[model samples]
Target: MRSPAAANPAPHLHLAELNSFPPPRSCLPFLVRRAETALRRRAHCHSSSRRSTQNQLHSLQIPGRISHGNPPPPPTRRVILLLLLVVVLGAMGNSIYKFLCGVCSDLSDAAFQPHGAHASVAALGRDILEFQRTKQVPEGLSRHVVSSPAAQANWYKKLQVAWKKARPAPTTPEEAGRLVVLTLKNHQKADVDGLLAFYGLPHPNEAGSAPPPAAGHHAPPAQHSAPAHKPQGVKFELHTLPVDAKAVADGDTVTVYVDTNDAPSEIKKAAAERTKARAARNYPTADALQKTIAAAGYRMVPNAKGVEVLAKKYRIRLSGIDAPESAMPYGKEATEALLKLVEGKCLTVHVYNTDRYGRSVGDLHVGGVFVQEQMLKKGFAWHYTAYDKRPELAKWQSQAQAARKGLWAASKPQEPWEYRKAKRNGNA
Candidate 1:
């Protein structure tokens, strides 16, 4: 059972006793040192991965000083060249932008620049607007306005185009004046004021309100305190004298009057003469002059308080209707009916056109009530569809017919035109 030993066995004599004995003491320290060295190598190898390597490199950095690694290889030649190129491109772009802005300032008249405007800008206001409107180069404006007709026309053409391009043409004086100054640039102040005044536009000196009336032009009566300027795209409004008891003629005919302030010169003179003659107690002369004044549609009528005032008269035919004649049935009733509606009230007549009979055919409005609508609804008038085609009139007439109101009470009522025709032909 004894194991074999080395060939030169120094006889320890008992090989079986070697199993109980340890090895040499110097070999223990050497083995322990080798084991420690192996663990250190493994730990260092495990921490040297890419992330750990990056962390090690990052920890070596310092601001403004080279603490450890070479300073990033002196910024690669390609990178340095690219940085230079970017700086140069930015500088060039700035220069180009400035040059374009300078060009724009110089060429564009609208832009504020040190052009002719820089030297001395004056007001050309309404002279500019008038020039645009008429285009007739005024005499003596050759020097003050423009150098020559060619230049004036060129300026005028520019203004004309700009005026048209400005959508919805200017309405008020202020709007017109603003547009005028903006369109025609680099003008003198006094000159602009004069030009604006010429066209009745608001002057810059007046702040923003309308200018005064022209020479020899009386202002419209203050009772209406009416807007001197009209609403855009709307027909001018006209007012009638206060309706007296006798002003209503029939359902379709009314004797309306306007203020003598709006009368013609000759009519005004006749009225004045009549007033003077009456004051002088020259009854005959006063009567003749009164007739002349009346013939010219100027009359002196008593108001609600019975004070006689001068006014211009008009025989307005209610537009779109032909009521029963005063001699026919419902004739008196129709006159009384219109009188009740319009008595002591001032009417606003929107005159569209004049009839062949020399009467102003217009839609009459008493406050909010339409005089024609009232007549048609009451069955006192027929919708003269031949002259006017308003659907509301036809509709109202149909309603009256269905309800058997007014003249519709008759089994078969005759239209006013038909009655007139019968009377004219002596057949009724």
Candidate 2:
């Protein structure tokens, strides 16, 4: 035994003495830890494999099978039951949260909201930021956009730009509102005004009027500026008109219906009788009455909601915007956008006058959104500068053109009006 052992000399002894000596004192702890850690890891891996194999005893032979690289899982039934319980609990919690949210708001909700516009850029920016957040301004800003720091930064940047553009610093509420209205184009008025009211700002009665000076502040020199008047002849307003998809006759046109009670007495009488005639199954009499009603620029038609109502029909041509014809580029898009916006909604129409084509030309508003503003900004229609010379319209068109949006995406987008002219002249 001694002879054999001496002859062998244990090959590992050379590596222990000749190739590697005792480690330096400074690194001894590290070396010890590393070696111990490796051994523990090996032990742990072996134990884990053994434990995993043991756990799968009650599992399916295939679904819970352990492969060379894969370890078996616990019983599928237990896992499924646990997952289902978790799902049910999650659903119940969500339902409760929704119900509570619907009934009333949490007191802590207002903790982050700014109390009012403090007449400073940063303060107003914060106020508007909160307002936009609470009201979901710009219609539907996604969380991805809203959650980023850029949301606050971009809002502040816009406020600064609008503030600088406003020249003299705004002291009162109306001027501030006007600034907001100008800056936040394509926003609904109700949302804008709600923000203003929250900040103790009043709606601007006339965009041209100067606001009253703040409390204890001396009056600034009265700048004499005449009230702006529309060149439109006999401007009138249609209190409300319900429109629909079928009513959208063209990109630049819509057919709006008002209640017969708002119509002329003669037309009202005719509409009333037509209802009775139809109810009594007197088709010929109803047809004759319908004709009489149509002669007064009125007709009975079902509204966007599909309710058959006796209404006064008006052929409405969108003012300040000339959309492409149906055959022209983006024509269908313009009509569809308008219909989607106005259909199933009651509109507030400011009728300037009837156009030469017997279509009532006016500004259409729904839920405080300016119809023409959206149309122009979206590049669905031209500003029709020949007929309407609003600087705002031109600005919107320029922005769209610069951004190459919608119709402007074309290399050489033709004006809808010009396209019509070329068609009339048979040049294209």
* lDDT per model vs. reference: 0.60, 0.60
The digit string of per-residue lDDT tens for model 2 on 1-428 reads 43321332322332123214565656655544444344345446667444433332222122223223655456997799899999999999988997664422232323223245234323455544455456333333322121234443454456545554444545544456567656654433333433443343434434223333334432211111111243355377664445655988777788887765667778778877988999999999999998998887788876433556767778888888999888888988988877766765566677888878888998876543567887888889899989889899999999999999989999998887788788889986
RMSD to the native, candidate 1?
Answer: 19.6
The C-alpha TM-scores of every prediction are 0.44, 0.47
Considering every candidate listed, which one attains the maximal TM-score?
2
Q: Roughly what TM-score does model 2 have, to 2 decimal places?
A: 0.47
Ten residues in sequence with the least summed lDDT for candidate 1: 113-122
Kindly list the per-residue Cα lDDT of model 1 for residues 325-425, writing each as its tens digit: 89888888889888876765566777766779888887776533567777888888889999888798899888888888888898987888888788889
Looking at candidate 2, what is the lDDT of residue 276?
90
